[model samples]
Target: MAVTSNKQGAAMQLCMALPENFRRQDFLAFHRRDADQLSEHVTEDSLLKGVVWQGQPACLSLFFTERNVSVTLDADTAWSADGQRTLEAWVGHMLGLTQPVAHFEQRFAADPVVGSLLQRQAGLRVPQSASAFEAVAWAIIGQQISVSVAIAVRRKLIQHASLLHASGLYCHPDAQTVAGMDEEQLKALGFSRSKAVALLGVARNEELVALLAQPVATAEQAEAVSSRLLAVKGIGPWTVSYALLRGFGWLDGSLHGDVAVRRNLQQLLQRPEKLSDKETAEWLRAFSPWRALMAAHLWAQQSSAGY
Candidate 1:
C-alpha cells in the first residue's frame, strides 16, 4: 500500500472554512461509504465526483485520472475554472457564507449531541445538498434491507448508468438519466419490483424538482414540500427526511430508517431496543434545521469505528 499527493494544479485559495483535496484511506469502513452515490450530477454532460461541503466543492483523492474529478466552483456560472477551485468556492457559497460563521458556532454550542459530534469528534463530512433522486431511490432500496446491500444496489446503478474511470472516481447520475431509464434495463440491474416502479414514477414527475427549487421561507413551505414528497409511492418519512436534508439542504430532520444510526445510538447509551421513529423524532427536534449534519456525524462515528 502507498500514499501519494503529487498532482499539479492551479494555485487557488483553499477556503480556510472548508476541507480540500482530502481523503481518509480508512473512510470506507468508517461510514460504510455513501453506498447510495451522493456525488453531485449537476449537469447532463458532466459527472461531479465531489460534493458541496460548506458551499465549497470537495472531492476524493483522484489526482492521477484524466477526466478530472474536481467540482468547479467560485465562478459566476455553474461551471468552474478548475474542478478544485470551483468546487470549493461554490460549496462555500451554498453554505451561506454571508451569514456569520458564528451562526453555526452558536447553534452547535447550544446542542450537545450535534455540537459534541462536531467540535470534539472527527471523521464526519456533511454535504450542502442531497441529490433528490438519489436520496429517494436510496430510501426505497433501503426500506427493509441492510445498509451494505443497499449500497451494493446503488453501486450497480452507478456502474450501469454513470461515468467513472479505472482510478475509482465515480460521477453521480442525474435525475434525467434515471428518469429516462428503460424499464427492462433497470430491472435487469437488480431494482426490486417496487423500487424500480417507484423510482421511475418520481423520476418522470417534473413537479418534484419545480417544487424543490421554490423559496422555502416559512414552516408552511417546508411542510408543504415534505407532504408532497411523501405522497409519492415507495417514498416515506425516512426517504422524505433524507431528501430534505441531502437534496434540499433542510438539515434539521433526522433519518428514521437508517439501521446504522439506530445501532450507533444504541451502542452509545447501551439501550435495550432499537430507536423507534417517535424517539428519533423527539431527539432530533432540538437540532432545528441541522439534523442532516447531526446524521452525518452519527454516520461518521460508525465510519471511524472501523465498521
Candidate 2:
C-alpha cells in the first residue's frame, strides 16, 4: 500500500491505498450502527474519536473511495513519524486490512452457502473494536440481551465515562476509566450487577488486558489467549471466542454460542429448531480457519435481508 503524508497548517492528513478488492460500503456496514457511540458518520466519511499511546486524544476522519482511504486527523502530533506508524497500525487493525481475503475466497469457492453469500456481498470485512478492552466490555454487556439494548447501554456508559476530544468528538473510555466507575452508576446506566462487576474485574487486572492485547498469529496462540481470558470471572466460552475474533482478529475463532449465528444457521440449513452446540461446532468447522469471516458474512447476509 502507498502512503502519503501532508500537513496543511495545523491539520494533518494521510492517505493509504486499499487492497485491490476492498469495498468501502461493505466495511462501513459493520460500523455504521455504532455511529452514535464511538463514531460519527457524515456523508461518506466516518469520524473516529480515539486516544493514542499514553492517552493522547486524537480524532480521525476516514474518507474512502474505490482504491484508497484518506485519514484526516485534527492533531499534528499524530502525523509525526512514530505517531503515523501507530495510527497506520491501528487503522489496519480496525479495517481488517491484513486478513487473507483471497485465500478465504478460494477456500469458500466450492462451499454452497458461504460461496453464495460471498457472491452476494463481495469484499466484506470484519470490522474490529478500537481496543481489546472495549471488545471485552461489550461482550459482557451484551450477554443475554438484544443488540439494540446492548448498544443503548454502551452509549450510556460512554457518555458517562469517556472524555471529549478537542475536536468535539467523544473518545471511547479506556479500561482504567471503566474500572474506576462506580457499580451503582453503571447499574443506573443499565448494567447488570454481574456485568458491572465483570467489567471492573477485567479493567482492574492489567495483566489480563496485556494478555488480550498480544498478537495471535496462529491457532495455538489464539487458544492460549482464549484460555487466559476464560480464567477471568464472568467470561465464558462465547465471550472469549467473540473477543478473540473481534479484539485479536483471530481468523480461526468462532462464536459457537452466538444466538445470531444459530439463527442464521437454522435459516440457512432449513432446520425447524435451533442447532445444538455440537451441531453448530460441526457446521462452523466447515469454514475452519475462516470461521470468523464466515460469521461476518452471515451477519451481513441477515442484515441485508432485513432480518
Candidate 3:
C-alpha cells in the first residue's frame, strides 16, 4: 500500500507501492502480448492508459524502485478518497497485490521444476483483468482461437465499442455495450456466431454479473462460481477455469485442459510428448491450492526472462 499525495492548487498527484516480491518489469512483460492490442495500452515506462474510476478516466504512470512502485497521475486529476480507494482496489486486482506466495514457496520448497520456478520468479504474481466482465469477455473471445487472433478481434471490438476517454485512451466496454452489438458487427471482427452469441449472453446475464461481483474467498466458493458460469450457453470448463483464475483471482484451480499447460509440463519433465489432460491434472495436483500460480509459472516459461 504505497499511497502518497501532494496538492498544488486544484491539482493532485498520488503514488502507491508495489507489494512484496512484486516486480514491475515482470508485470509489464506478462501483459505485453501484442503491439496492436491491449498490451499497447501498457507502455514501456509502465504508464497504463484508460484506467477508469467511478466512470471517469485517467492515465497512471508507475515508477518502480527496489522497494516500491510509485504512481503518478495527470496534473488536472483530483481523486477523492473513495475514488482513490477504488483505484487502489483496481490496482490490487490487476497486480495481484493481495495474493500470498508463501504457501507456494513452502509447498514447492522440495520440488524440482516448480521449486526452481518459484525461486527464480519470487515475486511473480498472477495478474488479473480490471473486472470480471473483462475477463469473461476475453475468455469468450479467445475460445478455440489462437491468442493472436483473439487479441486482434478484441482490439477491433474495443476500437468499435469502447468509450474514448478525454485522455485519449479507450476504456474496455462493459457488458451492456457488448450486449448491444449485433451479430454481423461481431462477425466482421472475426467472432464466430456462437462466440458472438455467448458474448452477448454473458453480457445480458445480470445474475451472473451479480454472482461474480461477490467476493470469492475460498476454493469452494470459487468452484461454485465456476459451476454457475459453466451453466451459461457457451461457457465451458476451460473458460470457467480461466475466468476463475484470471477474473476471480482464485489460486485453487488451473486451466484444466489448456494445451500450453500440458506443453509446459512436458517440457519441465523432459518428456518427448505432451502430457494428457488426466496426466496434467494428476501431476498438477501436487501444487494443490496454488495450482493457478503454478500455471502462471508454466506460462512464464515461454515469456521473457523477467520472471
Specify the highest-lDDT model's number.
Answer: 2
**lDDT of candidate 1 at residue 87, scale 0 to 100:** 42
Residue 250 CA error for candidate 2 (Å)?
1.1
Model 2 C-alpha lDDT per residue in residues 1-307, reported as the tens digit of each score: 7888777765677898898777666556655656464644545545455543346565767888778889876663534657666667777887789888778887787777667767777767677777787778878888899888988888888788757677666666787777788889999999999888888878888887777667778888887777777777778988887787777777777766788888888887789987987788888888888887777777765773111
After superposition, the stretches of candidate 3 with alpha carbons farther than 4 Å from their true spots are: 6-13, 37-40, 56-60, 72-81, 304-307
lDDT of 3 by residue, 1-307 (tens): 7687665443344566766567666677656655753523565556465544444454555656666666555434555766556656766777788888776777677786667877887877777776788788888888888887887888888888767665676767777677788888989989898888888878788888777777677877887788878778888987887788778788878665888878887898899976898888888787778877788788778864211
User: How many clashing residue pairs are found in candidate 3?
Assistant: 3
| Estimated TM-score for each candidate | 0.64, 0.90, 0.88
lDDT of 1: 0.53
lDDT of 3: 0.72
Clashes of 1: 21
lDDT of 3 at 218: 87
Per-candidate clashes, comma-separated: 21, 0, 3
Minimal lDDT window, size 10, model 1: 1-10
What is the C-alpha local distance difference test score of each model? 0.53, 0.74, 0.72
Model 1, 1-307: lDDT tens per residue? 1111122342122322323322223222322355444443223223335422333333432121222233222212233355454444334333322222245546676564556656655324344333455556666666677767777777777767654433344544556667879768777887777778878877777887567645454567768878877777767777777766555556566774567766776666568888886776676566656665566566666664221
Model 2's alpha-carbon lDDT is 0.74
